[model samples]
Target: MPSAPSVRSPLLDRFGRVHTDLRLSLTDRCNLRCAYCMPAEGLDWLPRTELLTDDEVVRLVRIGTMRLGITEVRLTGGEPLLRRGLPGLVARLSALTPAPELSLTTNGIGLARCATALREAGLSRLNVSLDTLRPERFAEITRRDRLADVLEGLRAARAAGLAPVKVNAVPVRGVNDDEIPDLVAFAVEHGYRMRFIESMPLDAQGAWDRDRMVTAEEILDRIGERFALTPIGREGNAPAEEWWIEGTDSVVGVIASVTRPFCGTCDRVRITADGQLRNCLFATEESDLRGLLRGGADDAAIEAAWRASMAGKGPGHAIDSAGFRRPARPMSAIGG
Candidate 1:
């Protein structure tokens, strides 16, 4: 017999935005501490007991799709591949009906080893974070020298047929800003979509000296000097503003979350490692869904909590407010 339709309320949020893309943080652990995400010293990670079990994550995802209209599921973390047996988790998440898009965001340190199994387990695409191509610069930025391993992972991802692999870069002025043309050229040559991200004040170590930020406008201008950028219309409330450089089947994107806020078109809801439903990246608040889930809250209740949080999502973050602070926790704790 076919399953009964859930008796939940309408899926559209108060913003009239339906929650379609869910960014699930599988683990708080990271192998590298990028300057933008965590403190230089270290941070106290959450106790194991606080994290949701794999089964708990799947249960929440089912409710999100069944009652809340979530259609895209992106697994993220400090580094999701750092989590053990993620292919199993991916396989389990892939089996959910309504069939949301399945993908992952990784630092690519371990992806070299796991890409094949993960692809077989049903991951559809990947966004790999690669800031600098120069091995020495990479070591300086991430405090680790594994650029070769990450390169192998990118190749493995392509070989495994991961479509539209995105390379995300956090452009810190004077640090790696000189490489825009080279980076764009590299992406075009490699058939990878490259995204230039403005450094936001997400953590203390990122230091986020406003002067050091290379805005999207500058990035585009520099690229425009080299290649003609034809803006492409985005689909279904997507995040990045895409522009294709003429004469190639390649496109470079700029995420203007910092310089040009796109909150009105925002359709993302983040689930932290501990299962708190966060509406905006800069929000000082978090709703504890894991408490209710582990405390015997049914799937419907979980769905309702997520709906309310998304419904309550602010039109945008208040980075300009007098009291606005970079969130107290590092990006690692918050799930970058």
Candidate 2:
């Protein structure tokens, strides 16, 4: 017999933020070695046994939507496409009562191979990481010559009918900073929304310097050189500050995570591939959901733990404060 629906309060923090978005990581394994995310040789991956089983992922997500008020779910990863049985997992996630909106973030290396299957399986949207359009620059940044594969994956994703296929690019000062205009142009031409993110302090190398990051102001200036920009005010807790390019219906967004923090309105929580619950992206502490799930705890216990974890979420990431510290895990391991 089917279980009755759970009636519980929404996931709210002491700061009065209601968490409605969940960023769930399926695996800590990735195919690319992006310069900003990982070292040339990637870090050690979690053992397969340590990862949350597909059944476990569904149960937790079910608790989130049915018990809590989570309405949106984005599957992240070192690269989510690397997860086996991805389409089947998406199908299960989509079948939940009050089914949350499903999205995926990927480097788009082999997305061409599975885009249609993923769309048919209930993926609602996609965000592809593409730093540069130049093949040589792409190879230099990623340490792999897979630019062609990524481009093809973008096209395949669009053809698969994924609307608003967002392209996420990080403009490193000495690397792809000069290509900002080109990147925006390409996105506008391709019917994809372009998002330029400031290089954050999440790399495995811990070499992030504020001076090397391309600021949001500078990004808008670069785009202004080629096209006039009209500010499109942000809606809700969205991290991106968007702008409309004159003469076209295309829009571009900038995530100034460092210079312009948006923590006051943050409404998202994360679950690592190994089942650690994080209230914030830069949170130092994690609540052990994996232990609870494996220890035979009931749904009520898991719900209590999840809510308790969010209660301790700090006011903000505090990247600019002197007391700020980077997370122990890098971006790749932390699911981007």
TM for every model, in the order presented, reads: 0.95, 0.98
Model 2: worst 10 consecutive residues (lDDT sum): 1-10
- Regions of model 1 farther than 4 Å from truth: 1-5, 8-10, 204-206
Q: Give the per-residue lDDT of model 2 (tens digit) for 1-336.
A: 224556868789999999999999999998888888888989899999999999999999999999999999999998999999999999999999879999999999999999999999999999999999999989999999999999999999999998889999999999999999999999999999999999899998888888889999999999999989999978678889999999999999999998999999999999999999999999999999999999988888889899999999999999989999899988777775
Report the lDDT of model 2 for residue 274.
95
lDDT of 1 at 54: 94
lDDT of 1 by residue, 185-299 (tens): 8888888899998888876465778789899999999898789889995655877889988999998999878778888877788889999988877877888999988788776
RMSD each, Å? 2.2, 1.2
Q: Which stretches of candidate 2 lie over 4 Å from their true place?
A: 1-5
lDDT of 1: 0.82
RMSD of 1: 2.2
